[model samples]
Target: MPIERLADLANPATTPRIVFKVGSALLFGAGGVPDREWLASLVAEIAAAHARGQQVIIVSSGAIALGSARLGFAKGGRGSLADAQASAAVGQIALAGLWSDLLATHGIVAAQLLLTLEDLEDRRRYLNASATLGRLLQAGAVPVINENDSVATQEIRFGDNDRLAARVAQAASAQAVVLLSDVDGLYDRHPSEPGASLLEQVKGVTADVHAMASGTSGSGMGSGGMTSKLQAAEIATRAGITLAIANGTHASPLARALGEEIGTLFTPVRRDGARKAWLGGRLRMKGLLVVDDGCARALARGGSLLASGIVEVEGDFRRGDPVIVRDQAGGQLAQGLSEYDAAEIDRIRGARSNQQEELLGYAPRSAVIHRDQLVLL
Candidate 1:
């Protein structure tokens, strides 16, 4: 779609599959409890979209903030991971209850979904989570998603929901993602600087904008800084999903963005189907296979990775695990689920199919990785 058309469709009123992300700063103040009036109004706008037949998914951040308030701790104490986890345990319930109660006022049901990065990295777990969210959307229930902070260690945490929201948009095949932050939009320079101008529409987030962005979060409580938001934009745009960064200070901010008058719009690079986008972008590879030059050419021309073409296998990956197929020069050519285990692949490397039984006493399938299971990078 053209940039102008994307702008037109992103207007909060017309978006079909809309994914809105709410940062912690917007949901709470110094006291840490939610601003009920502001949250209520935000729910009203989402309910309006639902009434208009638009499918909406909300990625919210505020569990830690709410948890701090409920636990009677200061917002900034340099707490350990255990402290943060404790807060999340207390705040998650309040967060979900608030959303459910507010949404119920408009006769819309809200369902809570907690996820960790691990869920998106594993193919089977990813599919199961996707199917559950899909069913909620199909049943007309608004799904509110958050990172599983309680159980997620620092290594596995999403850190911020901005990136998670982008991944979710790809998983849900959403048309656009709305990032509601404390600031209005992307500026040529820091908004606090003199003569800084707001960039209305960005064809692409260039390196210059990225350089200008400081690693500063507008709200002290949120983890996503301007740089992280830019990172999220890159991820969403590359997956062919439009992204809008706007101010969440006011109620009905999404409605304003939908009007195409209030946000920094990042246009899509290339649109991809839902499953393809998820498979190509979200699934984490478990292993790698190095191929010869001839096999590289065939793969570049849209061929599969056959046993005869493979030179070596690396990593202890099992069958059906996502693996990267690289050339001898270390250039990634494709990604796919492997049909053979690493040990089996090592034995069958460079061997023809007919010689498989003679060498190994058993032949798995002919192809090492089938074409249908592979995605050319």
Candidate 2:
């Protein structure tokens, strides 16, 4: 189907869930003051999305910038990590209050979720974060997510909200991710260059797509540029989520997105279940599990990988690492997250599910890899 048809402006139910990324450049006005007018318009859009039964999640940026301003720093004047982190600390409180108060005016509850890369990358934390966001949507509250700048070291940060928004979409199983920025969409060349035209649709992020990203300037307010947005598109599309880059500085950006009138859309065929999609993504597979024919057959029928799979485990991997499941002949069958680390799996190989605890000297977890976490490759 054409990407525009999915917009279904008259009835937003077609896109059940959307994650909008609001950058710092659009969040504040002159003198580091909050852009209440712009924010109010966005709050209205959120209310509209909810009334239409379209769940909304916001990955917003501005805490650090706001904090910087509150600290009496000039624009782009932060000279050290200490300065930036301190600014985020001061700004996050106001940011949360701003969202919560604005949303309250619409009778909507705003929930703040401050996260770092670790929150989404660790298995236990990932499950908790995803579940929390899902519950917020279910409870009719809008989740306002941002990078945990206060705690994140420079080397550990997402650096840009674009990728964070895409990851959040994956975590929450969102159907669409709209990156609202200073520019309308992707251009064939730098938009400033003559004949640099906006491309309406992108099938996938390719080498050519990366080339198009060069010289495309950002809002000069956010850390990300078109390059980061393209990275986001790759992440979102790989998980079967549609991503669009549009100019949020314009009036009613969501309306334009819903009307299919602006932005460069990147759409792909929907893939496996939410968790399965994560497993299928660009995770570095740490180990290979060789299962027997019976076990392989069971897996193909949507069954979880049992302890009795009688597999030969290759590689020393920790728990929660992605692993390739293979038949006895070493033919890859599927990919999944491993519940047990490699050593534990080796000890339990060929053992019954009930014997898992006996062999491991502890209560066993569920399947070696539960069906929900497995993706047939």
What TM-scores do the predictions have?
Answer: 0.78, 0.75
Pairs of colliding residues, candidate 1: 11-258, 12-258
Model 2 weakest 10-residue run by lDDT: 1-10
- For model 1, residues 12-130, the per-residue Cα lDDT tens digits are 35467889999888888777868888898899888988887888999999988888788887644227787788889888999999889999999999999999988886767878888
**What lDDT does model 2 reach?**
0.82
Number of the top-ranking candidate, with TM-score as the measure: 1
Report the C-alpha displacement of residue 53, candidate 2, in angstroms. 1.5
Candidate 1 lDDT trough over 10 residues, lowest sum: 1-10
Question: At residue 286, what lDDT does model 1 achieve?
Answer: 82
TM-score of 2: 0.75
